[model samples]
Target: MTSFAPDSIVLNRKLPLWYQVSQSLRASILGRSPQDPLRLPTEEQLAGHYGVSVLTMRQALKELEDEGLITRHRRRGTFIEPGVQRGAPVRLLGSVDAIVAQQSGMVAKLLEHGSSPVSGELAEYFADVDEVATYHRLRADERTGEPTNHARNYVRPELAERIGLDDLARWPMTKVLRDLVGVRIGRITDTVEARLADPETARLLQVPLLSPILHYTGVTYDEDGQVLDVAVIHYRGDRFSFTVTLDAD
Candidate 1:
């Protein structure tokens, strides 16, 4: 039997308790399994485990069933759908892990690559830096030709000329930061916010005008506290999500 990793699941207070529980359960279901009939804990048992009502647990299970990740028979218990483990790639975010793509079936299409002096709100992020410039802009799509994400990347002015569009299309910015700029990564900070898609953002992401979007901004800094790169990536709210792990003080 596959044991659940209790420590890996935490409920987010920002969302409804049922939604949070459903997401937690969904992660466990994604792991590959070879058991003939995978068995999930009873609704009452799960409710007791999570300290929520059985009604809340049923709601969470309903979400999984609606997504075709689980099935409930009249007499037989719930089981994970046979082939769901191989579904669309799930995006996971972490401080050290960064972006881990199982595979790059998603093709990158460069839109515009140019350089301009940083201004306004961006100036605060790279404080005391002489000059910053835009390095790359691209949108990515899945093998099925669905838009996945749109990203705008920036780097120090000194590296603007060295890092070109081809480089952006080939590999991730982390590689460019290490090879081109010669900076040993120390830490990464990520901030996620919700926003409404604008005209340009809508076109790039293929989302409806004014649709909900996830705005993610990350800043990479070296050991000396110097900012190395700044990235602003947008993900479709429906097709993508992020997982964050927090430890209690």
Candidate 2:
């Protein structure tokens, strides 16, 4: 079995010193104090412990803050944000199917279903395709009654054409891919970013603008690494945190 190593910071001339320091601290927090939400070290304490200037420590903290890994209060001090948990560290593969399967009682609603040409940035993924293929768009919610995430997925026409959009209101798209499409997922590539919810997302998620949201861009492939589907999911920052394990080897 091929096991991937955890991502880490390389302390070299190629990167800035503050960034390297921040990465080390972030890794420590993710690895050590995940369960204790309020266990973040004070900025001054961190600077003294790491043998860095207070400014450098502040810079490190700023980087973590930008990544949504930590939060700062005026006088209350810095703390880990609530509900953000580290997830298992695996290859960037099969994440969608795995996540949906792990979380029960989640529901998917098919918002739009159709076929269109792959254009712009998406065209690069399909290669040599002129006409638009079948497309499946869905909104997946992670809550029983109140939705915790709003996800949109796009798949190749041939793979998605036969699946009924109406079926999503009842079952997750992953199930449809398995039962209707008959494609066994092999790998997935995921890109994560933190952004404020848009107006539509804010309204649908019942949150105000500037509310934190985690955007996930994912692509799933078959056993032979054939592209199966691409998905974009938005999760409520206040409700969830992605987790991954890292080992120092």
Candidate 3:
């Protein structure tokens, strides 16, 4: 198990502080490996991370307890539920290598492959190209067949030509880009948000409409800082968790 820094949490002032804090803690718990210890940081330690008062931190933790995500014992500290770590898929963020390693265990189910006009916001990734190759894919745990992520990928035109459905089904997009296209990825940027699933997203992920989901938009940049691809993924809130690591060096 890796060290978890209590002061690493960053809150978004745009949403309720408690809601954001709860989600972060939930991710930490769900992301725990089976071999990892169940005990979590104390309330005071956790509160210090987000710069929140003890009462606010307690409220955030209460949310987890109500969801059966964690258990609290006096003098024993808070601990993740015994079974929670085994129930959901945990994806590590913060590094390309970590993401690739986690993704290798999942199988990609190709939903659709075709060309589509990029959104205005996405055009920047394609060097202002209006249309690009698009792939709709669903990733599931290979053993359990449980869907974890639904993703739409928009590839730069020339790069897209070399990639086909077969490539995506067998390898993660990052792997395909690195091993097949032979492109060196210099940077990866990811933004995550929690939102209610729309009808289309709900259908693809097999979750109820309006259910909470984790939305991620990730961009891959080449060695020269050129954008190579953009991926938009929807992860089932209950089925997925993210572990992000920070280095102090």
**Which structure among the candidates has the greatest lDDT?**
3
How many clashes show up in model 1? Answer: 0
* Tens digits of per-residue lDDT for model 1, 1-249: 554332133444545667667655664454323443467777877888777799998998997898777898867777777654222423443322224222122456777766666777688777777567775455454325667677777777766766656656645576567655567777778788889998988998788999998888878888988887888877777766666654352
Candidate 3, superposed: residue stretches over 4 Å from native: 1-93
Model 2 CA deviation exceeding 4 Å by range: 1-97, 131-144, 247-249
What is the TM-score ranking, best to worst? 3, 1, 2
Per-residue alpha-carbon lDDT of model 2 for 113-186, expressed as tens digits? Answer: 56667768676666656544443333333323566667666676667666676556554455568666678877
Sort all candidates by lDDT, best to worst: 3, 1, 2
- Count the clashes in each prediction: 0, 10, 0
Please, what are the lDDT tens digits per residue for candidate 3 over residues 122-190? Answer: 866775677888889998765577787888888888897777668787567986897678898887898
Full-model lDDT for every candidate: 0.64, 0.60, 0.73
| Candidate RMSDs in order | 9.5, 12.8, 9.8
TM-score for candidate 3: 0.62
Question: What residue runs in model 1 are displaced by over 4 Å at the alpha carbon?
Answer: 1-95, 100-105, 179-181
